[model samples]
Target: MAYTSEENYNPEDYLKDTLNKLDIGFVKVSNDDIILNHNLTFNKIFGYNHEKDLFGTKNLDYWLNSEERNKFREVLFKNGIVKKYITPAKKLDGEMIFLQITFKLNKNSKGEIISSEGIFIDVSERIKTEQKLKESEEKYRVFMETAKLEDLKASLYEKDLLARIFMDNISGFVVLLRPSTREIIAMNNYAKDMGGIPGLTCYSTIGQSENPCPWCLSPKLWKTGEAQHLVVDALDVTWDTYWNPISDNLYLHYGFDVTDQAKREKNLKELNQIKSQLLRRASHELKTPLVSIKGFTDLLLKLKTEEFQSKSLPIVQEIKDGCSRLELLVNDIILASKLESSQIILSKSLENVSELIFSAVKVLKGFSHARKQKILFDLHEEMFTMLDKDRIQEVLTNIISNAIKYTPKNGTIKLKSKTSKGYFVIMIEDNGIGFTSEEEKNIFTQFGKIERYGQGFDVVSEGSGLGLYIAKKILTKHKGAFG
Candidate 1:
């Protein structure tokens, strides 16, 4: 702590003694491999007898193994303090201690290697903790990405990855560009697939292109930072182009194939239009029979009296049967309404085949009798069917009504039912006008009807042609076999 002069200085030993009083280990060795000085902590940390091992040895080989000894000289010449160089040194007590030696060299005026000193800092615990922390960080990052994506409900990161994967397999021009400036800085596997846009001063493999490529959605992306989409039939191939903006100045674009989706949408619209028209016609069909059945039943119910015992039972039963027919008609209307918006709910049950068929045929017979046409029913009594009974009756009634309404009197209408090939084969054959091939294509479709008619026999003006359509939907709910 007092003033000192160089003439009276004991610099080397004084420095070693000063370092010995501190918390760390220190050592100094000469270029000729002679141990010169060391601190007290060096012996304490290495478990050495300070009195005996302080200057006992200084050969670099005395500390480093064969492999480390070779690298030791090179490191001393290159860098003074070697990094995490592992070595096991024997103490005066014969105990070996693992050491990490890091130190600096004192070079002389000749620019030659002279002597070196080092700080042997133990880092075993710190290195081990760092490895574990790195592993934990990796696991947490994985978990955070998964949970955060679901909570946010939109995978911004995954969207980037998916867009990359989508473009990878696609054979079209793709680009990631700066939106405002329209600088194309990124592209994918098929970047030049479309002969590259030419003549515009945008950054691309083509350098510049005049006309914005048909697939280019940059103009649209400038308006909205989302996937600006366009469908066009160009170059004899339908292309679905998409533009996705990444930032105010960044966007991605690609053209995909959407030919199939376009065709399906067109067909679906046409089919729905046809179905709407058919429902209009089928509603008319239901009301015609419904009005007569209701009118006749009211009159028949009024006619029955206690005095007329012979005819009373038959008349009451007839009225009850007509009421049942009217109930089925009402169910058809419900089915049509639901089917129009595709919202039909079915009440499926274990069906009595004979009962369901007889109930349906009862009304058909009544109609045939009213029209003076002959009809017969032959059904297997013991068979069973899983079905929505109301809807099946709708199918039968539409066909039977069409047959009887079109057939001349004395025409034969047959209702036949039998189990065959794991399904119920219920065929209603009549010697009346049947539909043509063109008409039969969408026969089960809604709003479809026959064109043939007599004077005042307007088929299109009849009940909603939704009968077959509603019937088909009902059968689907029951898992019923359909033709």
Candidate 2:
């Protein structure tokens, strides 16, 4: 409908029409926080079917926090108006939305508040957009920083190899290229001898390809501005290829023949396989005889006292101890071989850590008692986590037994456990001979035993040196750290 003229226009009708057409929701609430009247936009904004569904409802019911309504009223009363007050509100469906509200206190002539009139715009989408933009900016900033670091590393490496790269008599081939066009800009005598020259495309000159080589690293170098290295086979020769970005448009390419190195690596891998097989075989063969020797030694020790003299009895006990130590060594060798070959699989379950620690201490109690040492425990009442029960117990036993062997007579060993930063941590402390910094670095390696000088106490210094190594591997498999 069209208005005839200004003479026929009604101010109330014009205002109502303008408010109804606006995208914002408008509401008039009573002083008691009850909804008095609202526009069609208000009903839609609050997920109502019509104005009747919302009329007579408490305006405070839509506020996410009732205290916010009181604060809003206080602000309106103090200034008689509020503008662009942003807050969270709940819709009819209980979905939280951000709203930007502007309201004014409608007062009578006596300065008594009557009602409040407000317009609110849903600002949830705008808030979400701003958050996404902020995250994108952060990611871009990180990428630029990483790129700059890579460029600096490339510059340093280029500086170190400047003489070798520029000399024509160098053994390896070196050339400069335009990454965008794959054009060779310059080449040393070594590269020239290999049929490469200026004004020729690298892929055609070296790769003998009509198109760009599939293994070319120029594209990746251009993006990351970092050096790239790979081995490629062309012209019946294996080239250890390297590409480094000199600038945005220039790239340094160099490589040497690695055919001999490749052959040696293959031979070394075969030798390792053979070594592992021999170790497994030897461990298996030694295990059966060692078990028999231990069994016989135990039987002799249990024989009647009248059958042997007291001096012979001690010798029999020594034999049993030697057999036990050998058995442990054989077992460690087998386990190490399995670990190196990736054949060890962990069986995990929820187990009580306290119980596992207790069991380990029980197994090593005899050894500690023989040394006149003390073993103390400081653990939680019941701590449960997912781990391999037998494997974890083995780790605890090995570490505890090592503590017993290294500590002096009458020394105290304490085992403690606690949870920190989402991880279960166990610490073993002992008044034992510790390691030097260099020895500590190699302690976790296979056969990396500490060397001792003079010792007064009769401490057990003999071991296969594989205890800590195996313990470390087991803990690593359990996603736990040994140290």
Candidate 3:
């Protein structure tokens, strides 16, 4: 392959070698449109083993269809050259490929065409990439146009074709308006179908107001160049609208009907109001009877006569315990409901954390004694913190009581408290039954509960599943962390 310098080289040999090695397909055809010669690259591209395989093949037959060939010839003949014209071509194997071809007519001295030469570039892969890009762009456009209008901030100018397509395809009212005159410059199919027309003022077409609607956001958009969002009620329907600025002079006014959403919100508010009122009345009605039962049971327990202690004592004691449990359940229900509705307010003050924990433990000591369980604590000496004293007591009571209830008889419950990185942390560990790893995550969710089996006890103290949930909410409101 060694050759002399450029001055001694042959131009024809160099050209033939270069053409054969190029990635492009090179072909020369007679004026009758029959292929006469082709490079190796051309033969490989057309599924031919040799140039002779295409010697008499009609060049026009390579085109996928007669219409495509006719258009290519019409343009090539009128100009004598066609540069990078893209079209589908059929290969010798009958597979279709997209090609970008540049063809030039070779003319003799008499100015008559004698042959045609061209190069073909396989552009199938490029065409596929372009199609994918187009599809992705279409998806993005759809997302932008159909999303809640208030959330959209793109300043789509009128000259952008894709933006135009997006506007045309919108299922709700969309219009571009001239701010000063309120003239509708562009509108989507939905608006047009509703009697909206371009070149008319919005007040005359879509809007029936003598002046701009009081809630119109165009004025703010003109001054701030920021998207304005609002809800307006018209035509017995509520509209959630976005007014975005395309330029200083023009703005996009887009909106969709939100009547159903508005109605749902309204009904929810009314229902919550009714629930609050009913909760208050029910609390009074329910607690009155329990208080009477508890008062009579206490009076009966105070009597120490032989006959009273023998027969009525146990039944009265059971009634008293039932009343106490019912009262606790009622209080929990009320508190949980209030917490969920944000109806409870906290009263915070500087308090001793150790004192709160000890007080809660002492209050529940009788319950642990009944279960034959012991409570052990290793609390910091004097941990002071800002907290709602009553609420934190409630939190401590709930956690300690839960530990007691779940622990087996004769089980030991340990309570530890200390200051960690500016936070007063408390830990309650029981040697009864612990939750699974997955259950721990959702253990505090509203009404989240696990079925309990009474292993070595006479009765299982299953909860209403609101104690920990309420404690978590109270701690959250106080900016305290809980698990």
lDDT of each: 0.59, 0.75, 0.74
Candidate 2: C-alpha lDDT? 0.75
> Candidate 1: which stretches are off by over 4 Å?
1-256, 259-334, 455-461
Give the number of the best model, judged by TM-score: 2
Cα TM-score of candidate 3? 0.49
TM-score: model 1 vs. ground truth: 0.36
Error of 1 at 132 (Å): 59
Q: Compose the digit string of candidate 1's lDDT tens values, residues 27-58.
A: 78887767787777777776657665668475
TM-score for all predictions? 0.36, 0.56, 0.49
Model 3 residue 451 lDDT score: 41
For model 2, the stretches where C-alpha displacement exceeds 4 angstroms are 1-167, 179-183, 189-205, 208-221, 228-241, 352-354, 369-386, 414-423, 456-459, 479-483
Q: Give, for candidate 1, the lowest lDDT window spanning 10 residues.
A: 198-207
State how far residue 353 of model 3 sits from its true place (Å): 1.2
Clashing residue pairs in candidate 2 (N, C-alpha, C atoms within 3 angstroms)? none
Mark the 10 consecutive residues where model 2 has the least summed lDDT.
156-165
What TM-score does candidate 2 reach?
0.56
